[model samples]
Target: MDYLQSLRMFVKVAELGSFTGAADQLRVSSAVATRSVASLEERLDARLLQRTTRSVTLTEAGRLFLDRVRTIVDDIDDVEGGLLAATGVPSGTLRIAVQGSIGARYLAKLLSAYTERYPLVVPQVIFSDGPISLVEGRFDAALTNDTYPHPGSVVARAFAHLEMMLVASPRFVPGIHGSAPLTDVDPLVLLSHDDGTAGVEPDPVRRWLDTNAAHATHIRANNSDMLRGMAIEGMGVALVPAVLVEDDLDDGSLVQVMPETPLPSMGLSVTYGSRRNLAPNVRALVDLLIEQSKSDQLPVALRHEDAALVAGD
Candidate 1:
């Protein structure tokens, strides 16, 4: 028997003092309503209603059960109502993981606006050069490039593209000198991101180097900022995210090399545990990120252009 249905039928019948009246109000036939109440009484082994030819009334036991069941049904309604209302306004901490290079350069700018818009949401971020398990880390979502592997049970939404640019310190590769094909450079040392997390995709810079300059020496760092620093110090040429080095490029600290070589832009994606039962805060952040990526309001280094050949832009 459907216990809740039986309880509801009994309550309605008792209140209306007519089995037929309760059936009409509940949109069920009188026989089903009577059987539902009969099933309830048989299960409890207690008579809950006093029936008469003219009217129906509740017994003492029926009155007590009615009060408790009313509260139970009302509580269920309150919980459902509260959850529905919460879908519109997000609250609570929203933990996110981000790639180190993007985090250092542009994540903060995006988050500043997010905070202003959603003051109640507390955001915590984890910076990783490689992939991290979102579920294991207890992250609500992760911001990453398309090169990262998507874990099972996670859903990804691509928002923008990050261009990777080949850069060298002016002190190391001055103008008109470093513009040659990568193979022409002597004693070339390529700086790349070292693999840290399991199942990370191969670095595009390393792949480019292998095909173009098989003999170039390679230096690896687990973080992009370290690669940027090494490049700035004239240690070697590095393929760094454009967003992280916009100021350096403008200040003449770094120069873009081999501008003619076209490299595929990596897509920036947001990955969440699952689309099912997505929290309001996580949804809000993802929407904000998509909006920022499409508009001109993104960081200067992240702007997309049709003519530029560098990466990270």
Candidate 2:
């Protein structure tokens, strides 16, 4: 049997869940497609599919084999695409993940621009408030904050730094002013991503909680947008990316809590598998992001680091 061709036929059959459908797509006869998959299973000595008159399904072994086979196929395609880089246009589904509201606020625009440039590449976006795994085969690339753990098998390139600041509505905590010292403004309610259990390395907010917000009520939510909304409604004080609340600050809806103290800026990185050569779609997306990340019009983009960015730990 032509092993690679069999694998391709099986992959298409598994994806479409119909032998006739797979055969039509592969431009082969249904008998040829069925024979290829049967030959594959015979060689492997494992039943890869459960065939019924109505539909087809993958067995347990088939499911596991499918994942690895997909990788092998994709890697082959990536190498071929790279070889034809000069002539071929990048095409395929590009799956990307972003950390949270901050990513949605800023990185979404960059992705929108990327789609415009690479129309052939379909983009799938995942927005998460917690850790994202690149090796798990879920995401092709991700936008992650430096605070979160990055897998060693991936390469992380920090491009932008978000200057975080403590903020709240003036009506929430009336007496706090810009000139007031950090010691004087004791927050009644602390709105944060961590409920003091996350054990994230000490940042400005964590240090502040050590003194001022020590005895305060902890209002924890995984979503930064939710925390920002809470702060806007005068529910509590929150540490947020300054860029996200610019309009609120200007409109007197939200005020900066601590003006004198410097808050640690969170670094943003693009994480991908540590391949020798990136997939065509992945490389295009990353290069476009690096280009789009350095505009003087946006304060966060202006704060972007040089090309010599910090990599994964």
Candidate 3:
């Protein structure tokens, strides 16, 4: 018995829940597919599957074996594709998910340049503000503000850091003394992701306000754009990421309320599930993202040492 072929058959059977379905996918007869899996079980002296008239289910051993088999198969495919991609051409779909705010400001330009360089590569981008689980999602990779906890099964690279700032429209600025500290502002207008959490908690701006402002009120907007628009109309002071409001700051539409105390920068990272090898397409996308990260145009936070050096200089 071909061990690898048998393993593939087993996985297909487990996934499809029937010998006929597996056989159809593998383009072989149901009998052959069934025999291969049966032979595999006999060779190992273990039954990997439980067969009923209507459905097939994995036994305990089969469940454990399936996870390992999937990893191995994925690695083999990655290795094969990596070898093929060495010829200087990468062809495949690269699916990526990113935070809504980040993607809104940067994805269009990045995709344009990436596609121009590798026309054979197709790109799909999903935007979300919530944490995306790699195991459950079909995404080849993701760009996010937070790092993953389990690095063993995933590869992660820090790409950028973002500085958030407190700002208000010209009209709102007059409500408080021009030189007052950020906390003195009343009626804060906040923008946040609509992920069910109250905008007042887990937010640095909210924390700062709670600590410093004796009298603070909040108006929560579900989307960042809505938040910005409300703030622009002189609703109240807003704590927003600097990059998102750069243009407004430049045009004097928005004024920085507290420029002295910079909000701590958050790191942006690119991550993918770590396989021993990867498909040509996935590898290509990873490489491109890494290269793009090295460029000055990408948003990143300064390293502590780098910040120290700048301060000293």
Candidate 4:
């Protein structure tokens, strides 16, 4: 058995705390990963992990071994990465965590473009709306909304500036064309991930609700496409990414409401931990994102009717 390969697998299992998760990340089967770790343990004469149906954790000896092995593994990777960086041919599987499905459509396009440019690179994206630690989740990098609070440990760079706007069907909010106070809008659709009721940067919908002095929302969803769809169906007024509803506005199916009150543009960032040496594959991705972010063009526009498709994603 390759000792270095076993060490690499052990490190992943420790980081993710799941044999299955580590195996999936390494692109190997559970049995292969389990056997690799077991082989490592046998060589060391130390049990490195305590595995149960509920969780996988490091034993006392495992913890000590992990601390040393993690550093050794990182050093080896850095040496190999230095060569790859010099060659500029990023060849590896990049594990990425996406904040939510809100940007799924555009993210897919962006990754597609990235892969095309660097055929040697493979990106494995994990879609999650809730917060997941970059370290605990064992991610190479993360694409996140700007509002997501990061510890001082990570490096977050500009990814894209997504213009946001409030839109409604003329049938639902008759006062959309007129200068009516926000109170006239009966229902307000909200994006759940952006909720910051008590925090510094509140969700756009939360800001609107506070402005109108309302207590509740008509609809609250994590996906922007879903909110856009609600607005199109005349459910209520929704603040959504301009790119998602570009065609709707063009066709007049959805008209911009409250044009005077602008919604905050959702800023996206590519974040990675600062402690680790930037991997060549991760660096390549960040470089591409920065290049594309020059003109708010991270993703292509999608029709509002495609909301269901994006929601299911």
Candidate 5:
């Protein structure tokens, strides 16, 4: 058995606190990861981890070993980076996980520009609606709304703040009293993402609805696009991220239901595992995202409106 490989696996298992999670991160089977850690314990003649059906805990010896191993790993990474830098071109695969709507709306432009600038660097993007675990997913970085919860192993950067709007179809708005207080709107149709209301609370729209809209009816959709489509068809009102429905609102396909009550802004953040000496590709992509985020692009709704105005002119 490769002692270094076993030690690496052991450290990963300790950091994650589960063999299964470590396996997922390492791209190996759970059984293989378990055996690797076991082999390391045998070689060291120390029971490094205390394990149970519910959880895994590191013993005193394990904690000491981890501290020493982490330093060695950091040194190795620095040496590797110095050697790689000598080759002149930064080249590697960068795996990124992003939310579906943001990826669809903005990633293409950013990715196109990035590829143009770094032809040798390849990017693989994974899109999902909910947050993904950086430690479990083995991704180089993730673009998500929720910041990572754990410390020491991750770092987060604010990418952008998304402005949201509540919109309804023209037909839906005509019957409803425009001057009526937001609380007085009848048969209020609330569109939601996913089945349950996680990360939906403490939202501006949610807070407003909780305080003012007593008779509001709730509707759930699995994705933002679905919610927007339902709202555009006059099925109900949807509090959607402005970027997602700007085109429809501008084209008269949908109308802003309450222009005054803007949904509270939420940040879009990019996070990465804070491994020593981040991969060149990951570092390059992070810098690119930061640069792109600095530009003053119009909000989605305004951009859509501008397009319509341009066509008319």
Candidate 6:
């Protein structure tokens, strides 16, 4: 048995806390990963992990070994990266996961620009709105919102700031003057993100409704696109990222209702697993994104009437 390979597998299992997850990340079968870890435990003459049908947990000895093994593995990766960098040619399949909403417009443009700059690099993008596990997914990076300052074995860099707007269908609010008081909007129905409000503390939207429009009916949907569709159907009002609804607003299907009340902006960030020496290709992509973010080209634009309303308020 290759002890080095076993060590690597053990480290992955420790980090992800699932044998199946480690197997998937390493691109190996579950049986192979199980055998590798078992072989390591036998060599050490100690039980490293306690496994249940549902989860994997590290024993005390396993925890201590994991801390040391992570350092060793990281050092080896850095050395390999240094040697690869010496070749001065960047080439790799960069696997990335992006927020589903942003993937359509902004991310598509950024990716097009990236590929043009680095023709040697091929990108595989997964679009979803769920939490991304960089190591478990074996991805080079993730472009997402919601998980800011990501925890252990991960790093996050802000890529874009997305402003949000409160909007409603023209028929629902009818000639809704921009300066109209929010209190006066009658028969309010709020379409919101499905944040599982059964037990947990209410999210910002629910809390806002509770405080400002407690009488308004609330409907929950997971996707922002769905919320936009619901609003356009004249079902209710929705507070959504401005960029996602810009075309709709321009076409007069959706109208901004409360310009004076600025919904907090959502931040987009690129995240990757923590590594001492990131590959040159990955680093280049991260740098390009950061530079683009610094230029601030993706500013949110509200309609002219809405802008005036904010100014007047």
lDDT on C-alpha atoms for all candidate structures = 0.73, 0.73, 0.65, 0.70, 0.68, 0.70
Residue pairs of candidate 3 with colliding backbone atoms: 78-278, 160-300, 160-301, 161-300, 161-301
Worst 10 residues of 2 by lDDT: 293-302
lDDT of candidate 1 over 124-219, digit per residue (tens): 988876556776788998887655665434456777777778888987775334457777776788886664644444656546655886777889
TM per candidate comes to 0.65, 0.65, 0.61, 0.61, 0.65, 0.63
Q: Where is model 4 more than 4 Å wrong at Cα?
A: 1-84, 175-209, 212-217, 295-313
lDDT of candidate 6 over 195-279, digit per residue (tens): 3224544544555656766665778776788999999999888877787888898899999886886355555667766443577
Q: Residue 80 error for model 5, in Å?
A: 11
Give one digit per residue, the lDDT tens place, for model 4 in 189-238: 43333432255567544565566536436566776777878788887777
RMSD of each: 17.1, 9.6, 8.6, 9.4, 9.0, 8.6
Better of 1 and 5 by TM-score: 1
Native RMSD of candidate 5 (Å): 9.0
> In model 3, how large is the Cα lDDT of residue 128?
64
**Measured by C-alpha RMSD in angstroms, how accurate is candidate 3?**
8.6
Ranking by lDDT: 2, 1, 6, 4, 5, 3
Where in model 6 is the C-alpha error above 4 Å?
Answer: 1-88, 146-152, 175-184, 195-215, 299-313
| Cα lDDT for residue 308, candidate 5 | 9
Clashing pairs in 2: none
- If candidate 4 were superposed on the true structure by all CA atoms, what would the RMSD be? 9.4
Q: Candidate 2, residues 208-298: lDDT per residue as tens digits?
A: 5676656767888877888899999889878777878877888999988767766567677787763334677887876676776665534
Worst 10 residues of 1 by lDDT: 304-313
Cα RMSD of predicted structure 2: 9.6
The alpha-carbon deviation from the true structure for residue 166 of candidate 2, after best TM-score superposition, in angstroms, is: 2.2
lDDT digits (tens) for residues 91-207 of candidate 3: 678888775565357557677877897889899888765656665677887776543232124456565566767778998877666655555545554443343334323444444
Q: Please give, for residues 167-213, the per-residue lDDT of candidate 5 as tens digits.
A: 88999888666656566677677775542335533544455556765
